[model samples]
Target: MTMLTIDNLVKTYAGEASRRAKSRSGTDRTAVANAAPARVFAVNDVSLEVGDGEMFTLLGPSGCGKTTTLRSVAGLERPDSGRIAVGERILFDGDGSRTTNVPANQRGLGMVFQSYAIWPHMTVFDNVAFPLQVRKRSARPGKREIQERVAKVLETMELGHLADRQATKLSGGQQQRLALARAIVIEPPLMLLDEPLSNLDAKLRESLRYELKRLQRELGITSIYVTHDQIEALALSTTIAVMKEGNVLQTGRPREVYERPNCRFVAEFIGTSNFLRGTVASREGDLVDVDTDAGRIRLESPVRVPVGEEVIAAVRPECFEISRTGWGNRPNEWSGTVTNRAFLGDAVDHIVRVGQGSIRVRGNPAISIEPGTEVHLATDPAKVTLVPVG
Candidate 1:
């Protein structure tokens, strides 16, 4: 079942016009005689469907409209035009003729912002119980019911023992969990998270990532997560929608987007990739041969590129195998000098100078090599991705 659906969503904001104009002679003028106001599409015509019990993420860079899209769904930001629905309920509908908008409090969705947003004056128990108590008399749960629900949620979040502690006295991680406890105490059908773990320390953030995942699975709550961090998106999302310039470029599972990026931007944004530009030399089935600037390279790609057509091969650092001696009779082996190396705790990253280009190779830390030493690099053809030229 579809938990949430956004159809042709668009949100625009008025922006400043150009400060200067070009003259006939190509000289910049102080100001333009008349310039039209800029219309910035914060959320362009984006349509999406989030499945039940799935963690869907809006992944993009800053100012790329991810937060705007999420706010629109939460009813915090009124979109210029679009329709938002949860199951059969219409939360928002706006298109020229008809208009329907639900207030944020009535949307029945849980949201956790970047900040913990905990009330310093309240105890942990009251913080989580506040939402249940504020409801209308007809809809409100009884006092005992609210107590049981709040206690259950706090225990699930591992904050039960701290229920009597002042909200301001909790550690960063505990405070974050308290915020989550308050949100889930209502047991909303859809949860909206906007970079909830970003403010925590690295270790705590990592630990909470798995904790959030476990909570989502055990509680069976469908969630929409927004973040600019690629690793966080990859680690937590069941489905990822990659956004750029107010538009979504691609949506797929984590491994699909990482291993087979649809475009250059996705390949570059999702993670670090070494690109080699070249023209297609030959093709046999899924195998393709490209003559690049560094050397002739072969790769396997399902996308067909005609002979002589320009293309790029994107390879991740971990795909390459580095060694001191050459692997005899290897298919895609090249000898290069190690210009630099970094020990990343569990692994080593070596920057190998291959001809005029440099390729980064990540491998086991035990196989570390000194800089200025010559090393051979080899990668499987299937590991190299052939991206189309824009």
Candidate 2:
């Protein structure tokens, strides 16, 4: 079932010139008089459908409007024109003539922001219980019910023992968990997480990433997650929408998006991709043969392009098989000198100087090869991706 629907969402802002003018003159009227600023489209014609119990991620770089789009759905920012509905209940409908905008609190959606907005003065238990206590008189749960709910949520978050501790006294990870506990306490139809784990250290962030996935699965809560971290998105999302400059470039399952990026931006942004520019030499069904500077490369791709047309063959580092000896007669094999190598604990990254250009190859950490050593890299045709030239 579709839990949330965002259609034709557009949110605009006065360009930075307006803000600069305001800073210089100290007045909004004066700023407007100084210059007619162009409108900046924070979110332009963005639309998405989130299914029940799925983690839908809006992945992109900074200033790409992922946050703005998430904020619009949260009612933190009213969109210029769009319709947002949650399970048939309209949260926002802004189409010039008629507007139906619900207050953020009234939307009843769980939100865990970048900041762990826990009340400092409140105890750990109180922090989670506050949401339930503030409900309207008729809707409010009984004192005992609130305690049970809060206790259950806190226990789920592994903070049950610290229920009496001051919110400020907890560690960073615990506080983040507390915030999540508070959000899910209400059992909302949809959850909005805006880089909630960004503040934590790298190690902690990784630990919580799986923790969050587990919680979402156990709770069966449909969530819209916003983040710039590609690996995090790939690890946690059921579906990922790659956004750029207020536009969504592609949306698909993690594997589908990672394996078959629709465009160059997506191929580059999702992860490190070694792009080989070429003209399509031939095509038979889904298999494409591209002649590039690196050499002739064969790949299986769903994207159809005429022979002799320009295309880019995007190959991921991990897709290549690195070996000391040559794999004779392989379909996509290239012999190169190891220009650089880095130990990544679990894997080793080798920058091999292949043909006119270098391509990175990730392989087993146990098979370490020193720089300047000759190596052979081979990949299956199915592993290479044919990205269309834009």
- TM-score per prediction, in order, is 0.94, 0.95
lDDT of 1 at 11: 97
Error of 1 at 234 (Å): 1.2
RMSD of candidate 2 to the truth, in angstroms, is 2.2
What is the C-alpha lDDT profile of model 2 across 1-390, one tens digit per residue?
A: 999999999999988767666666456767577666778998999999999999999999999999999999999998989999999999999985879999998999999989999999999999999999999999999999999999999999999999999999999999999999999999999999999999999999999999999999999999999999999999999999999999999999999999989899999999889999999999999988999887889999878799999999999999999998987999998888999999999999999998898899988999889999999989999999888788
lDDT of 1 at 319: 92
Best by TM-score: 2
CA lDDT of each prediction against the hidden true structure: 0.92, 0.93
Worst 10 residues of 1 by lDDT: 19-28
CA lDDT for candidate 1:
0.92
Instruction: Superpose all Cα atoms of candidate 1 onto the true structure and report the RMSD in Å to 1 decimal.
Output: 3.9
Candidate 2 matches the true fold with a TM-score of 0.95
